[model samples]
Target: MTMKILISDPNKCNGCRMCRTACAIRKAGVCNPEKSRIQVIQMDECDRYLPLVCQNCEDAPCIAACPKEAISRMDDPVLQTVIDYNKCVGCKMCLNACSFGAIGFDEDRGRPFKCDLCGGDPLCVHFCEPGALTLKDSAMIQYDQARTSALRRTVGIRR
Candidate 1:
């Protein structure tokens, strides 16, 4: 079986933000949306709701941007790359490097946090009742960049 990557269908989303709540709980052990690795953005004017999370790029820009070598991938069962807050310097370079705007800052903790696929099974995927957020086979991960570019052209959304 192929490893999977998270995908969001803005058209299917209803802006309930359950994914964000679940992400926060799994990643931070809290119920705070602000602490969530995933985020839900509601474009009220356009009537679109987008759930954004780390893309886990093959050539992860976040990993390259971290001067501290704070980010690394887990290669055994899951290939998800994650941040090591201990090595992070709170400089926010990785935050700037992420084009998808998936990396999030913990204001109180002063470190960058992003989706780690919940160590294998993402809580956000489990809690996404609308089916807006789902995991697709990793083969599509490379194509997502081009697809997202096309989506951006259609919707004019930066994220």
Candidate 2:
């Protein structure tokens, strides 16, 4: 089986924000949407709801941007980018480096947080009742990106 990456279908999202609630509870032991690693962006005027999470890029900018070397991929087979809380010094460089705006800040911890795929079984995916979030083969990411770009063009949404 190929390694999987998290993907989202904005068209399928109903903006219920159940994914956010799931992520927050799993990661932070709380029910705060603000603490959630996955964020639901509501474009009310356009009537679009996008669930944004870390892409876990092969060449992740966050890894390069971290001065403390706090961000790095997991050991073999898991390949997910994770933050080392012990090494993180509250620097927000990773937040700025993420083009997708997937990295989130925890004001209480003063550290950046992002989706780590919940150790390969994401709670967000489990709780996505609309089926907006799913794990796809890593090879399909390029196709998904192209589809997103085309959709944006058709909808007049600029990156």
Residue 24's lDDT within candidate 1 is 87
Tens-digit per-residue lDDT, 18-51, candidate 1: 9999988888899989899898888688779999
Clash pairs, model 1 backbone? none
Instruction: Tell me the tens digit of each residue's lDDT in model 2 across 27-146.
Output: 999999989989888868776899998877889999999999999986533457888999999889999999989999999879888877887788999999989999877668778789
Model 2 whole-model lDDT (C-alpha atoms): 0.88
Q: Highest lDDT: which candidate?
A: 2
Q: What C-alpha lDDT, on a 0 to 100 scale, does residue 94 get in candidate 2?
A: 96
lDDT of 2 at 74: 69
Positional deviation of residue 67's Cα in model 2 after best superposition, in angstroms: 1.2
TM-score for each prediction?
0.77, 0.80
